[model samples]
Each structure stands twice: as C-alpha cells, then as structure tokens.
Target chain A: MPWGKQETKPRLSPETIDYALAKAVADGDIVNLRQLFAPASPLRAWSPENIYSPKYAYLLPPSEQEGERLFQEALALVRDPDIAEHARAQLEKDGPPQLHAALVMTLADNAVRLGKFGAAAQAYEWLRVRPRMQEEFLRQGDTALDQNDIARAVAAYHAGTGLAYNYAAFPEPLPAVPDYQTRALILHADYPSTPENCVAMQDPAAFIRTALSYVFLDAETAARLDARPLEQRIAFTAAFVRRRDPDWDAFAERYRNTCTFVTAFGRRLAQDTPPAEAEDGGLAEEIEEQQATADPREIEARLLGRSIPEGEWWQYLKELAYEHPAAALFVARQSVGHGVEIVMPRLREDCPLVEPLGLDVTRTSRP
Target chain B: MNDAGYVDYFAALELTAEAKQGEVRKNYRKMMKDLLLSIGRERLTEEKRDRLLLDMARLNAAFYILRDNERRARYVEDRRRVIALEEEWRGLAETGGAGAEEARRQFDRAMRDFLTTYMEDLVLEAGRDRECVEASNWDRAHERHAGRVLRHDRHRHYQKILERLPFHEVTAPRVNWEERARVVDAILTEATR
Candidate 1:
C-alpha cells in the first residue's frame, strides 16, 4: 500500500524535505534534485528562515520554472541583508552559477554604481534570489492563474480569466480553449509563455484554442495578446511602450513614469531592461497621442479594424467579443467602417486579412 | 442441410451474410458431420433421397455465398439497410429524396469497396469467374457426403445378411425380405417428416 494512504502514517515534517532537497541540489545529484523538486514536494510551500546563504549556492537557476513562485522567493532571499554577507563570502570559492549569472551580477554592480536604488535592488536581488527561485518552482498547480487565483477571475468571468497551463492536466475555458497560448494574461497578472509554460500548445488544437484563451484577462492584455499569433505578439510588443509621459533626457521624470509595476519587489525581479539601459530607450509614452489625434471616431473604429493576431480581423473581433463581452461590442464596431485608414498594415503576419479585408470592403461597399 | 424451401440458403445453413470464404469450409465441415450422424447410414426410398438431395443443394448454395468475401460483404450491408428501407417505404407513400439518396450512396460505396477487396466486380460475370470455381467445390462436397452414406448402407446390409446364417448350417442364407426392412422404414419416415 502507498504510504500517504495509510491511516496511521507518521506526519512528515516540511523542513525535513526542504533540507533534503537543499542537500540533494548541493550534492549535484540531478535525480535527487528532481525528486526533491517534484510536484508534491514537502518543501515548496514553506517560507525560508535563512535562504540566501552562499552555502545554498545550489539554488541558482531562474529561467527553468517559467519564473513561477518558489524561485521568486529564492530571489527575495539574496536581497535579505542577513544573508547577503554569507552569500558573498561563499561566492569566492563556488563562483557564480554561469555567465548569465555573471552578467546579471555585473549588471547589478553597475546598478549600484549608478545609484539607482530600485534598479539596483532588483538587479542584486535577481543575482542572489532568482537563481534559487528558478531552481524549484515549476510544479505549482498544473496551471497558474494569470495572476489572480481562480477564486478571483471566477467572480466576474467564467471563460478565460483562469487558464490551465497544461490543459491535459487541467481542462477549463470557453470555446473551451486551453490556457497554453496565453501570456502575461491577466491585467497586472502575467503568464509567461516560456516553452515550458505552454508544454501542451505543441498540439494543433492549441493554436486556435489557446489563441481563443483570453476569455478573462483584462481588455488591454486580451486586446494585446488575443487574435494575434505568438511571433506577431512579440513584434507588436517590441514597439510597445508601457508608459507615455517621460522625456528621454530626464532620468528623474522617466523613473517616475516608468516605476509602475505589479508582480514583484525590486530584488525579486529579473530579465527586463536595467534602468541604465532603459534610459536610452526612453520611458514609455505617457500622453495618449493616439487619442489626441485629429480624428477620434476614425481611431476608435480603426483599433480592432486591422485584425488583432492573424487570419480575419472579423474572426479575431468575434473571439474578442466572446472573450471580453463587456468590451467586444465597442471593439467589434472598430472592425466596421474603420478598415483602410488606421489599419497597421505593416503588422501583416498578425493582420493577414487587412489587405484582403480592404479589397473585400472595396469590392462590396462600392454600391 | 435443413433447407425448408421458404428459408434462404445462408439462413438455412445458420451462416451470417458476412461469413468469409474460409469460414464457409469450417462451418460446412462441422455441419455435414452432424447431419450425417443424425440421419445415420440407411437404405432409403427414392423420395427420401430426393428430399435429402434438395436440402444438400441448398446447403451447397449457402457455402458458395460464404466462400466469396465480396458477395458476403455486399449481402451483409444490403441486408442491414434493406430493413430500414422497407420500413420507410411501408410507412410513407413518398420516400424523401435526400434520405433515399444518402442510403443509396452508403450502400453503393460499401458494396464497391467490398467488391474491390474480394471479387473485383459486382456483375453476374463476377459469379462466373473465380467465384464459380468456388461454388463447384462445395457441390463436390455434397456428392461426397451422399457417397459416404451409400457406402455405409451397403456395409450394414451385408453384415445383417451374414449374421442371419447359422453356424451349424453350412452356407445358410436367410431369404426373409424383412431382414433389412427396419433400415428401409427409417428412411421413408424421415422423407415424410
């Protein structure tokens, strides 16, 4: 009989599992590392009393678990003043984990030199904590809520607010789509689309089903991610500036504008552009220039006009309507008379139908 | 070999329409053994022999149908839809064109695939080709069954004649015609029944 199933089994201490996992990782045993970090690991939920000791150098791998939870906590530990001294002392012998770690470590040092406290905090924290966080965070529930636990997204929407990271393991959605294709999915909530995040999108059904998964994420992100293919979402977001008010020459103003973030504390963060590098990129535009344009009706209607992701804009608009009914009517109207003028035709891969859409309208609307 | 004239040969032989060529040989061998055992070797009147012969012929027909995969496949498919069609025709004066067309198409497709797999043709010419050779094989089987029964009767008749001669009387041979009367009566009874 299985041990857990036994009625008279002894209660296992959560700390014992944590120590074993730490020791296993320290021993450079991948098999033991996997078992220690398995789905039902006893160590996962426990908060660490002393996490950033360099003795715990085994905790250095962040990109593995899709930047999910346990790893995020490991990120916070390196920033803890209590453990920083110990971690630095051990780094002398063990060295940092790898080159990426070295670069991030150097980057954090650069942040300290520049005296950008928030940036330096995140940079230093990522160097110390994120590696550990990545070491053991992939096996939360089969799926992560974009950010909100299912308990929240359920209150407002039934369809996509919560997505199953692996649908075969957890199946739910309207259009009954799986959550694999989704990313940074909820409002401030995020579902990273690392190759690991969407292990199931490997199936063809996920292409459309996951593309349809925005049934519950916020309108901007849903509008941002839905209707477009993955490669296209990247290109579209490449030009995306999350903020609007900052000037390139001014750091104080830019930092003030750029400072709004939702997920983690500075020390817990990693991967994004450092403050120094971002200074050259300029802060995201603050004022709504698109809203300020000479034509407001033209802009509103033209918004959903060019197709969101790929194939037909009408179809994507329909998915948008299905995903966010509260926003769909307004978005759907954009696909109406707003065809040629505001369409970002340059986004052809995502908006394959814009040219065909214009020609369709020209051919039909010529009465 | 129980071929009540009203019943079809395949049904009389207790065979499904889908029975394949090899299955026919398997089923027929067991069936022939049972029938001959039940009837027993006996001298029979001509009428009794004629009835048995007719029954044997029908059995032969059933074996032919089962021996060819193509015919059997079509027979199985047609038999399934035939009931649905007859019921529809009986229930309404007008057969809906679409429904009829669909059923017809399904039947046509199944038959074509079956024929292509087994006989390579649907027409009567298909029966004449390799399938005819198949039918003749079963016909030879029936003749063989009749021959065996005839030989058994002669053997029993001679044994009965020898037993009647007494050991003390040299060359004693009974002239009583009733000596084999029982074997003859048994055959006649089976014919009328």
Candidate 2:
C-alpha cells in the first residue's frame, strides 16, 4: 500500500503488471511483487523472462500462481544446491540491476524462511554490499530472527547501523531504539568482551562499580556476604575471583602490575601540568621513574591501607576485576591471603562467577 | 438540622464534612470507645442505663447511615431539596398571591410523603445497624479481634468536588448554592477538556 496507487489504470493493466512484476523483481521490490501476485489476481498468471523463467534454471518459482506461493516454492528451491547454484548463475548474467538485487534479496529472504541460515547469511552479505539496500539487510535480519537464526540477525542489525541517514524523514521522529548495540553485542558473542562491541565498558571505573553488584554473588548468600566483616569480605572475594579465573597463574601477576600502573598513571595524569610544559619539565621524567621503580605490591598495599569507606573497597575491587580479571584476582589474592577458599564447593567451576567486565585493561597497562 | 430531618452526619461524628475516610474511622472509633467507657463507669440505675442505651443506639445509627456511600449521597440530595423548598415557600408567602396557601399546603404534603419514605428506610437501617453492632461485639469477644471498619467513600468524592472550587474559596467554611453549582460546572469543564 505504501508503494502507492493500486488503482492507477496504466499500472493495473495485465501487460503493465507483467512489466512491473519483472521490474519489481529487477528492482528488489519483493513486497510489491508479493502484492501484485496475490491470490485471485490476474497478475498471478504473469511470468517474466528472467532467472525465474526456466523451471530448473529458476532461483525462484516461475508458476503463474500468487506471490506467497511463488516465494514458498523459491524457499524450497533454495534448499536444493543444484537449483540454488543454477539460480545464482542466472542472477550473475542479469539484464537489469533491479532484477539482480531483487533475486538476491528474494533468495536471502527465502533462505532465512527455510532455516537455511548459512545461505541466508551469505545472500545478506551480498545484498549489504549493493547500493541503497540497507533496509533489505534489516528485513533479512528480522526474518532471520523470526526463524531463530541469531548469527544472521546480528549481522543484519549490525549492517543496518550507519544507514539510518539514507531513509526518508519523519515529521515527529521517535527516539532511536535503545539496546540495539547491546543486542548486537549479546548475539554476536556471549557477552560484551572487546572494547568496540562493549559500549557499556568504555568507562573502566563505571564498569567496575556495576560489576560489584549482587548479580555476581549467589542470591541466597548475597545478604550474608554484605553483612560479613571487611577482612572476611576481602578474603571471600579473593577466593571467589581465583576460583573463577580460567588461568589464575597467568592472570594474577598481570592483574597486579596493571592495577599498579593504572593507579600511578591516573595520579600522574590528574596533575595540573600542561602537556607542552610536562614534555620539557621533570614531571614526565618523575612519572616514568615511578613507573619503573614502584613495586606493585607496595602500591597495592598503600591503596588497600588508605581508609576506603566500608563497601567501597569491594566495589573498587569488583570494578578492577571486570576491566582486568587478573588485576582483580591479584588484588583479591593479596587482600585475603591466597590460602582461604571462601566460595561453596558445589558451585559450578565452568560457570563464570561474574559477567565479562568488557574493559580494556591492556590499554592502561601500556606506559 | 434542616426541615428534611437531615442532621449533618459529619457533625454527629464530631468531624468536619471534609475529613478524610481514615480520619472519619479513627474519630468514630475514639468516640464509640469514650461513650462506652462513660456508660460502663456509671451506676446502673434503670433510668440512667436506658438513657445511656439510647445514646449508644443514636451513635451506632449515625455511623451506619454515614458510612454507606449511596445512602449518604441520597441524604445530602434530600437536604438540598428541603432547603430549596423552604426558600420557595418563603418567597411565595412574601408575594401573598391567591394560590400561596394552596402552594404551602402542597409543599407540606410533599414534605410528609418524603418523611414517610425516609422513616421507613431509617427503621430498616437502624435494625441492620443493631444486628451489625451485636455481631461485631460477639466476634470481638470470641476472637479478641477489633474487626475492620467500613470507611466512608464520600470523603474522596467531596475532596474531588472541593478541588473544583476557586483556590481561595476551597478552604472556606461556608459555600453558597451558586458557588457549589459553579464548582460542579468547573468540574464538568475540566472533564471535557
């Protein structure tokens, strides 16, 4: 209906419908072709001389039936490698740009509908590279989701981004859908890990604070954990972190060194010295000297010794763990004395105690 | 207090008509307790006991009548009509028209009919109230429980009505018929808006 003028005399003629169907197939107007070839319509009898003309040569169904029926047949054919291969070859020898794009999109959509996700994903990849077909990619993505195909869905949604500016303007624009990026991150991977994918972890400090929430603790023991004495809490967290670490030996030292560097670097960065002046002055030299000479253990001790308010130290440690699991584990090991195992024995070893903190600890580790 | 035998139930409960439902129940409970305590401490001379019983019966009757929203609304409407009728009679008498006496007689007949109908309702209401009070007392004795009291819904209705009044007039003690009608009109206007 949005395509306009269903009753236009010239557009409604059988000849016009045939031309239009071909044009629609050529133009990637799958929606229009669907409407034109609806059941009980004369256009349903029209056949175009394209990749869809031959029975085995077709990528899509060539029968003079309704569009949906044609689509169903096409979806079935897409599952057959020989038929699919024939269709792709015909599409490559395209007479019209519209036909080529339309055939590609139809194949992708049919592939998605038929639960052929790999084929759908490949077709969608091809469609995305073509001109002005971002919305088609989005449609394919949504179709993929309807079939419960997550990989293609993530690919499609990710492709739709940065293409919003190409669409027509609205009078009263709505707020952009929230959690699109988050959804992509979730579907693309198990959780936010890399810096580019994990938008929430851009701020290492904030990410650390959120990681300290009761989400990480067992629901039944969360209240008791909160009530524990500070020393006990530290010891409990240390054991929790170590047990969770996949490679505690490699992580422990790296974490400690990174935290020390982050703290000292943050301190030096916060100083009022301007960049130009700092380059010429001893400030840069002093920071470099400290970075080289300061024992991470002493820095960790000094940080822990400071009168951090109750509950804040755990939060700081949790945040550190999220951004740098090793750092958090190292801090935990140092605080509670590594010998004590605080968590229950029955807890699943494979299950992560906390969500991936999605922070880039390596960036801060660099001098 | 008006000619319609419509006593201010709010006044009987020792409250302003604007009192909230919670306030009404709290004050009603306090009043009932105080009345019962006073009656209990007194020497049970037959005459004194009969008088205390009558007072307790009146308190119970007033509470029952006021607590029910539909009955209270009907009572308020009747009171307003009685005031209107009285004003009409006074105006007719001042003119001293030929049919003024006939009009006055018709008005008295109407009042009698209204009173008869209301009296029947009052008798039934009083009987229901006595049963309710007895049942409540029995329950309290057996369960050692203070039963939940029904709250007057009219307080919310009255508050909403008051909100329609002019800002300065909303808290005023007295509101005339014209001001009240205007407030109703304001409510209608706001609802349409």
Task: Please tell me which predicted candidate would have the highest TM-score against the true structure.
Answer: 2
Candidate 2, clashing residue pairs?
A26-A98, A26-A99, A27-A98, A208-A319, A255-A326, A255-A327
lDDT of 2 by residue, A1-367 (tens): 4665443322233333334444434333344443343433233333232222233132233345335554444444334555334433433332211223334555444443333333444444333422233345445545554655544444443333312221111221121222222322222232212222232322333232222222232222233334434433333343434433435544433433445454555544323332233344344345456667643234433323332333333344443444334342222221111121110001111213222321224334323
lDDT of 2 at A233: 38
Which lDDT values do the candidates have, in the order given?
0.32, 0.39
Candidate that scores best on lDDT: 2
Off by over 4 Å in 2: A1-367, B1-5, B45-47, B113-120, B130-193
- Tens-place lDDT per residue, model 1, A1-367, is 6766733323434334334433432222333333333333333333232233354434434345425443344344334454433333332222211112322333332322222223333433333332222111111211222432332222212211221111111111011232212332221122222222231222432432332233323333244244445544332221111111012113222112222221112221222322334332121221123224333222222333333433443344343333322222112111112131111111112232223223112232311
Specify the CAPRI tier of model 1.
incorrect
Q: What DockQ does each listed candidate score?
A: 0.01, 0.01
RMSD of each: 35.5, 27.7
Candidate 1 backbone overlaps, count: 18
